[model samples]
Target chain A: MTPSKQEILSVAAECFMEQGYHATSIDDVARRLGATKGRVYHHYASKIDLFFDVHREGMARLFAAVEPARETEGDGATVLAAMLYAHALAVLENHTFESVVAQGVQMHRFGATTPGQRSTLDELIASRDHFEALFKNQAAIAKKDGSLADVDISIAVKTMLGGVQWSLIWYRPNVDSSARTRANLAKQMVRTLIDGVRTRAALQQDKPERRPSRAK
Target chain B: MTPSKQEILSVAAECFMEQGYHATSIDDVARRLGATKGRVYHHYASKIDLFFDVHREGMARLFAAVEPARETEGDGATVLAAMLYAHALAVLENHTFESVVAQGVQMHRFGATTPGQRSTLDELIASRDHFEALFKNQAAIAKKDGSLADVDISIAVKTMLGGVQWSLIWYRPNVDSSARTRANLAKQMVRTLIDGVRTRAALQQDKPERRPSRAK
Candidate 1:
């Protein structure tokens, strides 16, 4: 049976994440799928095309997860927290695709792409900027609403996003598997990021710190 | 004039960071130095060797910055914050080397290195693990002292380290130049990570949140 494009992309994303864009080839993707290079070629004209598609699909998944949270009725901090939670879960669940997205971002940043691929790279970067803007806007609102601490919104948002996104490099799914584990991990990540920016009063009510020893 | 090995590593690190290991050649590094490949080859046997050296230097710089803070007389929270601040500065100041370090970590993680280079890769990995252990031990102490929140020490440390390290990917020195900017950026990052884990009372006194209006 001929594998579908989505199947091909899934296998290709895994190969790319494992081997990297420069090292991964259509044959590698095909072999991983237990198929021939022709099978992959039928879906993707070239390796670069397949790579960009995986990147685009990864961004789409992130949007699907967080867009709802962005639209949900809540204060800025609440909305930002919801969006961050959704994003962390999406990253954990779609690890391979997100890794590709990260690779694509680096490729563009370092001018590793060919001239022909520049347009697609630009589109991907724009999507990333848009995604970042969502968090930035909400963070600004949260600051104005007095829910967040007096921090630089741009730096705070970037650092928070960076913490969540770096999961691609560090999170090993094989070691930490299970739906509960994933959810708990996402919750922990969200709490750290959101609480990092929450107002002192709000943070006090949210998760009170451990009691200090009198001796100390 | 014969360029020193340190000079070659710095140039090679810039080449590797900008163009990646596969695309960057010894000739490219030498050309960027306005010399011949012989200069680079004289100091290093192969491109992989140079790459590993850059990775080692990067790790060494990080240790130089953070190890002092580790030994300072202070509580865990104070120690961790100092270490993180020093780390952020190291990453920003040595952006090229740190970028190479990040690339090396990813390369090793994804099995991109050849069998010949595996031992060196293992050594680099060990160094990275040692660095993380410093943060983990201090976080444990902070938690015990009731200075930190009741979060998983491992997760919190990894996430905090991730946020600071991801600066290598997002920080642009050309755009945000000056010593003051770098120092301020590091301070902000340390505050977010440390405050995120600090007890509510501790955070409140350190940097009070903006007051909210009762009209809302």
Candidate 2:
């Protein structure tokens, strides 16, 4: 069966994440989709184009998750936590896309520029910076409200991102790891990151009535 | 002048990280070292051997950082902080090797099996688990002492690692970002991770006398 463009992009992302970009081909993605090269090419002009689209889609999903939280009428901690939880869930749900995006992001500095490279690279950077800016702004607010620890904004942002983004590499869909279970786990993970920035006074004021017990 | 085997390994790691494993050739490494392929082969049987050595060196550096903290006489919090600080410094100081190791680690499950694949894979997994276990043990101890938050150890450990390991991608040596500056930044980053897992009661009792002021 000829797969849809979306299907082709999804399969291509998984292939890119599984095998490095230089090693993967449009044929590999087509074969994974049970389609032909012509079908894959009908949508994406080239492998590079397809990879760029996958990256754009991943960024879009992340922005979709956090953008709403950015507009929410809540405290900085609440906003940051909401955005983080959404971002984590997005990463868990779209592991292949997220992983491919992450790999592309790191390799962005290394890859040789091709036709249309500059524009795409700039767009990618802008998308990423925009997403990160949300957290940075909230962190500023959190600090003003005296909810956050006296941590550098860059360190705080990167640390929070590292915790969530790394999930793409290690998290898997398991029998017992249901959607709800994963969501809760994501919340706990984000809590650790958010709490890292919480001031001592904030920590005292923001205790949850029900906390997960330590597994003995 | 012909470079030593140590220099070859170091240069090869940087190449592998910059150009990737498949795209990087042994000849490329030799050229980087102003040596011939024969000189490279004398120390490493092939590109695979060099890559493996790079990974081993990366793990050794990380273990070296954390192991001393484990032996020190300190509370769980102090020990965990020391280990994390050391780990972060190792990652920053050896960004190229750490980046290559991070790439290799994530790609290990995808690579084709070689003659000693099983044993090497087992060894890699064991080394990684052993390193992570130190954090887990400390978290367990911290819990027993009621100093840690009631979060899952697995989440806490991964969160902590994700923050530091991701630094390989974005961190750079700059004029203002001196060694002392980076060390202090690493400390702040670790504090966020450690604070995430610290109990509210512990948080109150453990406030540092000095805090980094918000960036103006």
Candidate 3:
């Protein structure tokens, strides 16, 4: 049977994540998919096309997962929690694609992309910025509502998002593959991040100076 | 003027971090250093040697920055805070070297290294594991002391460390280059991470049920 475009892209993402862009070739993707080179070529004109498609799909999946939470009607902290949960789940579930997204981001940052790919790189970067803005907007609201700690919003948001995305580096699907486990882990991660940024007032009603030396 | 081995390693690290291991050549390093290739060749036989040396130096710098804090006389929470602060500072101050370390880790995970480099990679991985164990040991002690939240220690350590290391991706020394700014940023980051994992009882004297839905 002819492999679908989605299948090709998925395999390509896995290969790229495993071997990286320069090391991976069309033959590798085809071999992994158990399809002919012609099969992959039918879907992607070149390796770069396959890579960028995977990158785009990764971002699309992220937006799909988190946008609903951003649109949810709730307090800033609540919305932010939902978004964080969704993002963590996506990272765990779609590890390969997200890994590609991360590689693409790093490549762009370090000028690893070819000049011809500059436009696509820019568009992907813009999408990433837009995704970050969603969290930043909610964080601003949370800070105003006194739900978040009085930390720099940019630093807090970047650190929290970095923590969530860093799962790509440490998480192994083969280790804990159960859906319930993933959901629980996601919830725990979101809670830890939210609680970390939460205002001291929200965490306790008294004894603000418990850790006097470290207290802000 | 002859460039010291230390100077070569630093410049080589910057080159490796910016252009990646494969793209960077000895000539590039030489040109960047305003010296001939012979100078670099005199200190290091090949680019691989330099890359691995930079990786070693990065790990050594981290150990130097963090080990003192781990050995300091304090509770786990305080010790962890100091360690985290030291780590963040090391990452910011030695941005190029740390970036190389991160790249080396990724490369090692992906099996990008040559067969000959396997032993070196193993040694570096051991160093990384040892570093993580320090944080985990402190976290366990903190948990026993009722300072840390009741959560999975492995997940917590990985997620927290991931967040701290993720600074490599987002932090730009050119943007906020001042030592004072870096120190302040590091403190804030450490606080957010420490606060996030601290037990509610530790964070507050009352009102534990305020966010009941998220409460463990």
Candidate 4:
């Protein structure tokens, strides 16, 4: 029996993560899905289409997971912390797809195997930018509210994003660790990240230190 | 005449970054070096050997850049800020090799094409761990000094390290921006990241508000 589209993507993500984009073939994906080439081709026009679809699905999943937190009523710092925690969990749960999505931008830059789909690339970039903007706006609000230090928003945003994204590299799914434990680990990291950017005034009524002096 | 080993490694890094480890071969490296295959073979037994050497050099460069700050006498926060900035600069300067090195660990995990080089892989992992320990120790000290909020040191260390390493993905050397300008950008980022985990008490004598409740 032919597998569903979701089933195909799940198997395909595993293949791409293991063997990489260039090495994974449509036939291999079909074989993994326990379906024929005709069944696979019926769903995806080509291998490139399949890869792009994986990228899209990954971004969509991220937005779905975090967008609700953006709508929650809270101070900017509160919202950001919540959103980052959600993002970290999503990454851990959907690592295979996230891995492909992470490489998508780099692959696009090299014009590797991605056919003339500038619109698709733009759409993906736009989605990514929008996701970042959510954090950037909240960060600015946090600064304005005196909860965050007066730091460059771009730098702050990227740093936070990087930390959450990096979890994919180190988080391994094993029988020993429960999903709750992994989620808690991600939560702690997100708290550290959000706490890092928060203004010192919030904690100690102390003056916020800019850059510390380098000892000669 | 054959190029030096250093020259060969440089070209090989470019090739691997562009074409990937599986796709790039020793012959390709030789062609890029404008030398015969024999010359390439004389210095390296296989492409895997060259890759391991690149990983070693990248780790060495990172240690060279950040280790001095570890010994500096100052507040732990100050020392950490200095070390992160230096590490960022090292990443930007040694981007190509660092890119390859970043993939090296992931490649090893998959047991992909890396032949009986368990010792080399273990050595690289040890170096990576040692480098991270430097940051981990400082973060712990920062917490003890009351400069940082009481948070998990492992989480803080990985978050900071991830932000610095992410620069390799986005930073590009260009005529439009001078090295100094790029370095300064990295510095600003490092400052924001270090400040993120710091205890607000260290910065604010003014008791800033925490968790601003959302306005209904």
TM-score against truth, every candidate: 0.88, 0.89, 0.88, 0.87
Model 4 segments more than 4 A misplaced: A114-119, A175-177, A197-216, B175-177, B197-216
Query: Relative to the unseen true structure, what is the C-alpha lDDT of residue A47 in candidate 4, on a scale of 0 to 100?
Result: 82
CAPRI verdict (incorrect, acceptable, medium, high) for model 1: acceptable
Candidate 1 chain B: minimum summed lDDT over ten consecutive residues — where?
B197-206
Error of 1 at B134 (Å): 0.6
Ranking of all predicted structures according to DockQ, beginning with the best and ending with the worst? 4, 3, 2, 1
DockQ, every prediction: 0.29, 0.31, 0.37, 0.38
Candidate 3 accuracy as TM-score: 0.88
Give all candidate RMSDs, comma-separated.
6.6, 7.7, 4.0, 4.6
Chain A only: TM-score of every candidate? Answer: 0.89, 0.86, 0.89, 0.87
Residue B118 miss distance in model 2 (angstroms): 3.9
- What is the lDDT of every predicted structure here? 0.82, 0.77, 0.82, 0.77
lDDT of 3 by residue, B38-150 (tens): 99999999888899999999999999999888887665566777788899899889999999998888778887667889888889989999999998898888777655666
Question: Alpha carbon lDDT of residue A38, candidate 2?
Answer: 96
Give the TM-score of candidate 1 (chain A).
0.89
